[model samples]
Target: MIVLPYLQTPRARIRLAEASDAPMLLRYREENHAHLSPWEPLREPEYYTLAHCLKTITEGREYALQDRGYPLMAFDPDEQTILATFTFANVVRGVFQGCHLGYGVAERMQGHGLMREILEPGIAWAFGELGLHRVMANYLPRNERSAKLLAKLGFEREGYARRYLRIAGVWEDHVLTARICPDG
Candidate 1:
């Protein structure tokens, strides 16, 4: 597993969410509940509670220890506000050095290139520090924003996964994409 670092970007910092950040994490979920519903799984209102946030952060730490994954949060540099989360999940080491990517940006943080800022170093750390050779991401076909970001990050659109993901409780189609570290 990789030791999480505070990644500096032009507009934000990306780092691991701490137990102390439970309140802010809960706030992120609450504020983006409606705005993220379409793209995210249906969450109960209380799913964003402090207790849940604390448990999730603790779980993330455990997962990192098992080399299962790393969960990262993006924050506004000036105010130190959590703005988004970027996750590298399903990590497979040994010969199959790879992982899957998942993310969500706070509604207010959208359109300011925060996604790219967080992803650039995140992906680098995946390859450089975690010894990953490939990273994959998938998105609903109608999610133009996600598709664009994957492409912008040099991920190739591999194919469509027919009814592959159960999102919002429905099996939905997704465009599969991947990026291989050239230097790996």
Candidate 2:
């Protein structure tokens, strides 16, 4: 099984979200709604609700239990505030031994390098715990921040996709990138 309270940095404590985290997550989503919408699947009206946050956290919990995904969150040291989130989703074992990564930082915390600190150890944990051979991360072509971050983290661009995913209610193309496990 995946571990919890996986890593800690001066600015963040990275782990899976718990039921008690619903309020903090709801606040983060509500506060950063506009900032994230353009890069994310369009949100429904109920997505802003406390109930929706709780439900999603519960689903994340189930995903971890099944070894299908790990929805990790970077919380402040006190665990009262969320700093960022990254999910190692679509985990596959056996021949594939790979997964897809999706992440976002809180709007107010942008450009502070908190995501880097959180992801460094988090990615290491994925390679160690899951023994994954590859982790893929994709982003819209216009998302220079993501493109740069992934590059800095050693994710090499592999290809481009046309109309890859729907974001903010529109189909958007994406740049595909992947990082091989150091021990792969």
Top candidate on TM-score is: 2
Report RMSD (Å) for each prediction in the order shown.
1.3, 0.9
TM-score of 2: 0.97
The per-residue C-alpha lDDT of model 2 at residue 21 equals 96
User: What lDDT is obtained when candidate 1 is compared to the true structure?
Assistant: 0.88
* lDDT, candidate 1, 1-184, per-residue tens: 3576678888787888889889888888888988788887777756878999999999998888888989988887863578889899999978889999999999997888889888999999898888899999999999999989999999998999999977898889999999999896
Off by over 4 Å in 2: none
User: How many times do residue backbones clash in model 2?
Assistant: 0
lDDT, candidate 2, 26-136, per-residue tens: 999988888888889988899999999999999998999989999999999999999889999999998999999999999999999887788888888888987889999
Q: Which candidate leads the pack in lDDT?
A: 2
Q: Candidate 2 — which pairs collide? A: none
Lowest lDDT sum, 10 consecutive residues, model 2, at: 1-10
Q: Any residue pairs clashing in model 1, and if so which? A: none
